[model samples]
Target: MSLEQSSIRDAAIKAPGRRSPAANAPSLESLVSTARALVPRLRERGQQTEIERRVSEETNQLFHRAGFFRLMQPARYGGYEYGFTALLDVISEIGRGCTSSAWACSLGTIHQWLLGLFPAQAQDDVWGKNPRAIMCGSYSPITAAEAVDGGYLIRGKWRFASNVDNSPWAVLGVQLPEENGAGFLLAPRCDWSIEDDWHVAGQAGTGSKTVVIDKPTFVPGHRKLTFAEAASGAPPGAAVNPNPLYSIPFLSAIPVCLVAPLLGTAQGAIDAFVELCENRVTRGGIGGAGARLGQFAHVQSRLADAAAAVDAARLVLDRDITDVELTAAQGRRVSVETRIRNRRGHAYAAKLSHSAVQALFSCVGGSSLALDQPVQRMWRDANAIAQHITLNWDAVSTMVGQHMLGLEPKGAY
Candidate 1:
């Protein structure tokens, strides 16, 4: 028998039977409200969170108890089976508290959806024993691997694994030998180690560090998925989990996760700016004594503009989220055109969010620049998220333009 078949047989014997979510799965409204409630506490912990260079254990536990990680998890395993739009609502609200915390939550939550796209056996292997398990991933395929009898021997370092400190497993991208492309492997905690190299000026609490597989580790075949298979919009998981959400093209909506936190980050900046303007008084300037900052026409205009930009950003994101969900619901594949448009929307929304925060940051005085000030932290974290390659305006716009201009796009979809 093939090693892969043998591995499958072993897993089948150990894997538990499927089950459905509890009768009282969280409603979308309840999840959003729960996220909103986390804000005040998350706000209280924001500065110390960054200083600690990772989300505190208490915050993670709160998310666990609130069912945030199960937002996009499979219903068969007690996940709410909520879609991306639900993710948008909950994660953006969380961002209003702390960008780093929101980011950690975003990655943790979205990866559940991504994992649901994997084959059934793989999903069972990860979640069957621990329904609450959440994983971190590094999707770049720069690591090394060799095809073996059962699966492959993988060994290398993958970087930018967000929320790694809090996750017990990793989805590491690997380039299969002699293949034209790369794929992903599901590795447990025993297969890899974390490198504490996450020091940064922004989004520090995400703890996005490197994961090193110090030795050639044997990964079972059922736990592997190639990028080609994922992009095909007919991922193996679609058969086991008949939800259309799983059938949506990988790149079409997955990038949405990268920008979702920024939506809340910008809104959070807007909130802080409003609060700052309401009570801040101009002091000791030549002609500006005892003036309420909010009274100035120019300051008012900045606030209005920031609000409009952030509002527009949410509309754009929601539009695409709706489009993809509806398309998937109707049992149609997300077309290439829609995919490119969604890509543009993701990058554009990110641009709007970054610009909004930048405007508010410029208007806020030096006092806001202090390490603990919410607006400053929001600005820093927004800038950091905008730097993500998927959200880089120039790169995504150029790729979209190329597709529109009738040339094959050169970038990752």
Candidate 2:
């Protein structure tokens, strides 16, 4: 589809479930089932999404209809009040079909959950009346915010604001200069403007542009959430929401969003490779193509290994989410070791996903290299996701090793 046509369609597509007056929302299981059912249709639109350089309007509508956005939203504003597992599950399902759509949705949906860590007034302003309002963010300390009388004046630009085109709000990580020392802070979307700067080789549909805030506006005191406060497990919404899910460490849950889509993309590659192998015929050989492909013990072994890796990644993610929810339910803080393990598992999953795609690419032969081939797209998408800093294999492995050996670890956890 043409860019103009896609934009027009996006404008016409109304946002779904904008703070429904009715009470009692559907269960997270029901939401997951619905998302799973939509996978085939979403997969069918993969080419369109890649071509448009963003998720198609129809796919976005389907996700909205499934209440996918509310999986991590606050309950007071008509959200499911579900835990982290639901978010991971939804992203996994979507990623298995279209990596770009899955990537965009995962970033957008998780941003909503992270927004809850901000001040209560900021939460109310964004979701008090519109629970469906999506948000995008850049956690890197790339911007600056000045402390004014009632609020902070933010001025800076954040690159790779994923799903910015589809989101109405954003949170830019900033460094605020104080009399004693500099501190980290979060500034709302209203305080910034978006710059169209995303141009990449893969996951092009995410529309992860650069967000520019050249003295755009001011953020109220209530909306400013400090990085120190977040790390200490204290957020402005704690008094109002009072849900343990809100208390889990942010670093633990955020990386899952980055890795889950890659897992799904790997699954897509496996699926495509399997389908191609089934109908393929060997050229200039006595045996049929399928027979030849199947006859190679090495090929069979790699396929099994790839499948195992994908399943193992999915299992680790689900288990980690469950553990996080359980810790939250107990009203206890997650251990530093546990958090590191979660990151380790996610990074391991990313590595396995990359390995799976590489295996599939090797077995699928020269035909898989075509630009239009599904396997080729999945391969590119998986590799791209694996390159994410959050999924950096070496860093994560070193962190995990440190934790196992009782050494001090760096960064937020």
Candidate 3:
């Protein structure tokens, strides 16, 4: 047998029990409220977060104190069993003030939810010792795993691992060749090494790097989760977590969380643009820039439209999250149509946010184009977020149309 297979065998042999500590936890609603209240402070630190190429240590500590990471963690540990809506609200609020900070926090916090979907033993190894410890992840199946006695030996490199600088653990996507077909696996952070390769134009502080796993690392049977299991709506954590929220389809919830931060970023842009408009003076013109800015029908129209777009997007997000939460509470599977529609809503929001930023920037005139201007930063961040595959207009719009017309959806919906 190969070294990969050997590692798999070792992992299977060392299956460990799931771990949990009965500690007091904060409520998810309260966490959202606190996050909203912190937006002004986060906005003040936005430049600092960008300069550090990661969220400021102070901001991170603040979020941790607010229990932002425990929104989706299993209640058996010190976590509130809230669904996707609360997370959406928190991310949106943060993004509204500082896009990059919001993105980092959102990425760092949501990994806890994903971790809860792993096998109990895998969850134990991560949260058993420190429930507050966070995990960062990337779900690209760039690596391969070979099955052996108790588990599989995994080897591959996953790119775009966000917030890895702050995380002690990671979960990655791997593919294993099987007799019947191929199996997609979710494995723990211990099996891989992180590569510092994050370089990007906007949201530079996200620290989205490459996670490298050379040769093979052992992942025990209990620690492995397959795409088939996820598709069946029977994740390994089901027996232990016993929460319907954990049972929701992975595709539906994952993308929603991934893109929600952009909504917050768009809000931040609007706020900044409005503030600039209020103080800016038109140079070498008959009327002052502020007076013209306020008086122009075009400016008023654009602001109204942008505000409406952001609000509409928020409504869609709220509605979709409510569906997920209600369905989970009722102990029923969320329909594919609902998931597809939710994806559509998310994509639409992203598109609208980009447009809103563009509209606001256009009204700000040439002076706002300076790199130092907050409006310019918001514009750049909004465009960057729009480029994400999950927010791809073509894919999401097409998927929703296909589902609506009684056609099968493609990709991870």
Clashing pairs for model 2 are 281-289, 282-289
Higher-TM-score candidate of 1 and 3: 1
TM-score of 2: 0.88
Encode model 1's per-residue lDDT on 189-273: one tens digit a residue. 8889999999998899899999998888899988988888888888999888887888888888888788888999999888888
Ranked by lDDT from best down, the candidates are: 1, 2, 3
For candidate 2, give the lDDT: 0.73
* Top-TM-score candidate index: 1
**Count: clashes, candidate 2:** 2
Backbone clashes in model 3, listed as residue pairs: 12-150, 95-264, 95-265, 96-264, 96-268, 282-289
TM-score of 1: 0.93
What is the C-alpha local distance difference test score of candidate 3?
0.73
Candidate 3 runs further than 4 Å off: 1-29, 179-191, 284-292
lDDT, residue 409, candidate 3: 75
Off by over 4 Å in 1: 1-23
RMSD of each: 9.5, 8.9, 10.5
Instruction: Write one digit per residue (lDDT tens) for candidate 3, span 264-335.
Output: 877888888788767766673565533646567888888888898787676666666666656766777888
For candidate 3, the C-alpha RMSD (Å) to the true structure equals 10.5
